[model samples]
Target: MKCADGGGGGGGGDTEAEDGGGVNVTLTTTTLPS
Candidate 1:
């Protein structure tokens, strides 16, 4: 059960990470211009 839960959570985490990465890139670009 634990292994199954971890696998599911890992997939969700990857999607969140991709979204977070895009936001981070945008923030860094805005900061660099200032």
Candidate 2:
């Protein structure tokens, strides 16, 4: 489980915070050993 504590007042909210609407946002990631 996770949480998103955001305070984006239309700046990034109007930008990077998108999905299948043309943009994408990955909130978490895990990198396996190369």
Candidate 3:
């Protein structure tokens, strides 16, 4: 579950307090480039 928490943080917010869609898109883009 730690990885899930980290994903939210890496996405930008501690949880869904921020725009999840934007964060998800950012994460996807970053993951693809590497």
Candidate 4:
């Protein structure tokens, strides 16, 4: 399956998105220059 690709550039993107949102949140919070 394309989702099984090593690049993680396929159906797995959705899963990553869910799993990665926390990273984005922390990034935004830290980068906000508070």
Candidate 5:
């Protein structure tokens, strides 16, 4: 159904956003220590 697909898409978007934020934080920390 359309509703189910929409929900799944939203969840995937949230996960991607969180992953991107985590990666940015890790890069910043690594750079700061060098």
Candidate 6:
């Protein structure tokens, strides 16, 4: 899942990994100049 571009404010990415009935979530953020 990804959030819409925050108009140069910032952006983030979320990933979910499933492993043997376990769920792992990873989050990443990106920065951009307007």
Question: Which parts of model 1 are misplaced by more than 4 Å?
Answer: 18-34
Backbone N/Cα/C clashes per model: 0, 0, 0, 0, 0, 0
Of the two candidates 3 and 6, the one with more favorable TM-score, higher being better, is 3
The model with the greater TM-score, 3 or 4, is 3
Give candidate 2's whole-model lDDT. Answer: 0.28
State each model's CA lDDT, in order.
0.51, 0.28, 0.55, 0.44, 0.51, 0.23
TM-score of each prediction:
0.40, 0.15, 0.35, 0.34, 0.39, 0.13
> Per-residue lDDT tens digits of candidate 2, residues 1-34?
1122222222344554444222222232111111
lDDT tens digits, residue span 1-34, model 5: 4444444444555566865655554455445544
Give the local distance difference test score of model 1: 0.51
Clashing pairs in 5: none
**Best by the TM-score measure:** 1
Q: How large is the C-alpha RMSD of every model relative to the true structure?
A: 12.9, 7.6, 5.8, 11.0, 13.9, 9.7
Q: Which residue runs of candidate 4 sit more than 4 Å off their true CA positions?
A: 1-18
Best-first order by TM-score: 1, 5, 3, 4, 2, 6
What's the candidate order when arranged by decreasing lDDT? 3, 1, 5, 4, 2, 6
Residue 16 accuracy (lDDT) in model 1? 62
Candidate achieving higher lDDT, 3 or 5: 3
lDDT of 5: 0.51
lDDT for each residue of candidate 4 in 1-34, tens digit (9 for 90 to 100): 3222323333344566754754554444444533
Candidate 6 per-residue lDDT over residues 2-25, each given as its tens digit: 323332222121222233112111
